[model samples]
Target: MDTQKLTIRLPESDVQFIKRFAEEHKTTVTEMIRRYLKQLQAQHIDEADAALQSITGLLPQNITEADTRRLYADYMMDKHR
Candidate 1:
């Protein structure tokens, strides 16, 4: 995967803690942060999917994506007329 360097400032204590933890875990700090950020990203995507699923019941079972698109197009045309 492509990677970019990021720079950040932290308290000396936090920096030391990360170093100590990384040594104990036999992993680099970069890998630790990568796992943390990936989990946050996954949570965001799961939340978005849940939001869409929650709204599905509000629409008619017989309606489809094409029907929704056509209806939205008609509404926009009327709105601008």
Candidate 2:
């Protein structure tokens, strides 16, 4: 796969921390950043899956508009409580 260069500006202290962390893990700062970004993407996917699962079959098959509104209101109230 092809890759492109990214230039980022960070505080000196943060740069030092990243350098120290890379040395301790025997990895480059670029690799650490890539791993962190992949981890974040995985976490976002997991959260989306959870949200979809939470709403699965939430409404009844024959629910009317009024019933849907009432159900939504109740759900919101219960969530706040």
**How do the predictions measure up, each by TM-score?**
0.73, 0.69
Candidate 1 lDDT tens digits, 31-76: 9999999999999999999999999788789998999999999999
| Candidate 1 runs further than 4 Å off | 63-81
- Clash pairs (backbone) in predicted model 2: none
Return the lDDT, model 1, position 15: 99
Candidate 1: minimum summed lDDT over ten consecutive residues — where?
55-64
lDDT of each: 0.96, 0.95
Model 2 lDDT-worst window of ten: 54-63
- The most accurate candidate by TM-score is 1
- Model 2 per-residue lDDT tens digits across residues 29-76: 999999999999999999999999999888778899999899889999
User: How displaced is residue 62 in candidate 1, in Å?
Assistant: 2.8
Error of 2 at 38 (Å): 0.6
Clash counts for all predictions:
0, 0
